[model samples]
Target: MLDRRKILTIGGVAGAASVMPLARLAHGDSTENGVRNATSHHHHGGKVTTRSVAANAAPPLDPFSVPMPVPQVLRPSYRTSKLDQYVLDIQPANVEIFPGFKTAALTYGGTFVGPTILATEGRAIQIKYRNRLKEDANVHLHGGHNPASSDGHPMDVIPAGGSKVYTYPNRQPGATLWYHDHVHHLEAEHVFRGLHGFYLLKGYDEARLNLPSGEYDVPIMLRYGKFDEDGQILFSPYDDVSTRTTFLVNGRPQPYFKVAARRYRFRLLNASNHGDFKVNLGGREMVQIASDGGLLPAPVSRKEVLITPGERAEVVVDFSDVPVGSSVVLESEWGPVMRFDVDRRGFDTGGPPAVLRPNPTLPKPTVEREIRMQLSDDQQVFWINGKPFDPDRVDVRIKRGTTEVWRIYNDDSDWGIDHNFHLHMVRFRVLDRDGAPPWPGESGLKDTVSVPPGTSVRVQATFGEHLGRFVYHCHMMEHSGPFQMMAQMEIVQ
Candidate 1:
């Protein structure tokens, strides 16, 4: 079940000698005032996708709920630089969204997503990260706790017009983090050829959780691209089944913002690299007060909310009742990507905070443990327990705060390949999928889950209570970095 010619061949996008294979697997162009040419390369391609979880027939305790209305916007600003960026051949012409089909995407700075670094938790960001595209870049800031050489270390590169001033000194607190291009094997074609960005991390309890501040607060940032008709950017080779038609919230595409119905405050971010957003609200009703480490002690009004690509939700949409012009959309999973028009002018009735301060939910765990995740694709050595990702080795370990019951299975029906299981630092509680239990608007709390392939999910957490070393990989950012699928959680103390 593992030996597709030995699998593990990192760095792709040969598309016709277009080259950019992570800049020949990280050679060196160096930037950020140091290290000029170190070429190194020795991680040996990359390949891991195993499968094995067959208990079947236990699905349906209460799974089926969709309805999200909480819509709000306004809170995005980025335009900082020190130039010299260029990864390789370079791309990014000029686009806002919806033109001829191939929907604009080629970022490093021209935004598909690549700028939004507002920091202040511990302070010490530094940044110089340049790497203008073509190949070989490194930024990684997903959750950002920083360390491990400023984190982005897969093969770590800035080559191709090099740059790297990393720094990272903002230890926790504020949230909604992001920053991609974790180059290993060309991180899913440089994050679908758009890289990525959006790393806000303020602090002081999100400015005292007043909630909707400055323009009502907004940071949508969803993503999904698949262009090619002379538009340039079009990369996908982890198992290309291609299910993206075209969607992008912050990078525009179906974009159309113009709200004013009042109470807005949406910080939903499903930066899709492999797609899995069920987000709903064509009719409107979103409340969801926080996720991914922030707020939520009360406030849950769903219409649809599934976000799972590194995850993050913090809804609060109250459009008052819609009258001005009536137009409020914001769906994903393919169905009307971004719209918000409420016009009619002025209004603010208030209806969003029954309570939401720092409620990361906690009250159901006597000790549990169940992990049944399955996903297969014979010929190419892809697995989870069947074997593939072997970074030297360290499969699984836990002991810090102990609390288990993590079951996830997606028997890849031959070649469905589209995972995203991220765990790192703990955050679980799905409870059932093929056995039922999961509808208090999804019982709350989650780190990342998009199992779709065959289906047999199950979860319930408690992992050593965050000691350090963490990671639960497969967010499909190209098979979870370097297509190895990823896995790691050492919390032993």
Candidate 2:
């Protein structure tokens, strides 16, 4: 059987690495071992991390034997003054996830992690997604404040061989957001099979700040996995998330990342189905500058960052302070999953940002709601407010431009699995957790907030101006999908 050991080769013997081709380096620069040298400001490093809890597992391969794969940003097929347009062919592909192995998977433009889409804030983006997969599929710009038609509502889908265009105004602040499959009952399976990607909305005015722009700003997607003997991704959502003992950094297990000696901003997205990742750079301090809703009002220094599934955290680390040839291992709850080796002398341009972006002013709370999340007695169905998802049933109705407070509770003590809440089309500030002030680590505006068993999380947000229906539910795909733990809300004018 292809146990976790057969796929992941963790840790490596310290050594200097040679350079790879400029093109491959541009698209993640996966040089075999150690960080490869880049010709320009780009580093051999990528935005990456992994998750797993199997500490006793042995490995068939050496650790950090592959370079971290930074997903390439998809280029617009054509550009217009009003918007940048692109096309994505959603189809099946055999991706090489393990050494000498090809895993059956689906992809957007033929990559496991799907190509990233970079959009400019305030500039519109149009993506014509052509579904070539065997089943119906739809694109959800998770966390995007898009029109109802483009928000990827659970009921809206494109049949096989069909296509649809999703338009995003990108009128919000720069944030680390993402896109993924949003088909109703099949969401978890599709995402697990690889139908997710990053969608970074960059602020037009941020160029004045000079904060790790260009290659230095990396988007790393973190995930956990279980594989079959043939190295194919095991589609199991009901299994204990901890049973997935293989940590994969952007789909590759225990890869190496080459970083420049200058400060770098990493946008980390926890893309796992149920696993929450606790990652750190071997105790070195990392300053978190942003989260799901974009730049924070100020930086929050932390020793470790815990990100639940569907959440994002942006942090900056200065490698200049470390010895040039020395390497730092990225440690997780399961131990080292990736290595960051300082391979080159980098030119540092950005310093610690005194103030990042400003927070949006929301209307005073005029509505209040309590959301109770729990699984049925049989654990065969997940529910929000004691009911499964019903697209036509609007569970919440909030007047537009008015703020609301939601006290979300996890009532599954017997099951005692971690669950998170995600609301589409709006962003909010977490006010408190379990009736106490939120921890300093949960400072930024977010669309998703983790709610551990027996805990209650309160958040406030003003409804979007758009008059339409949206959904809010546990971000655990299985819980929200076939188990139907999601519910609909309407923004009424």
Q: Give all candidates' CA lDDT scores.
A: 0.56, 0.76
lDDT of 1 by residue, 260-318 (tens): 77777778887766545666886568888766654555678888887767778878887
After superposition, which runs of candidate 2 have C-alpha atoms over 4 Å from their true positions? 1-59
Which residue pairs show backbone clashes in model 2?
9-63, 25-29, 47-220
Q: Write the per-residue lDDT of candidate 2 for residues 276-389, one digit (tens) a residue.
A: 677898789999888899888888998899887899999888898778898988766445668888989898766766777767666679889999998665445778898889
Could you tell me the lDDT of residue 334 within candidate 2? 47
Q: By summed lDDT, which 10 consecutive residues of candidate 2 come out lowest?
A: 10-19
Tell me, by TM-score, which candidate is best: 2
Superposition error at 101 for model 1 (Å): 4.0
Give each model a TM-score. 0.32, 0.87
Cα error, candidate 1, residue 158 (Å)? 39
Which candidate ranks first by lDDT, i.e. highest?
A: 2
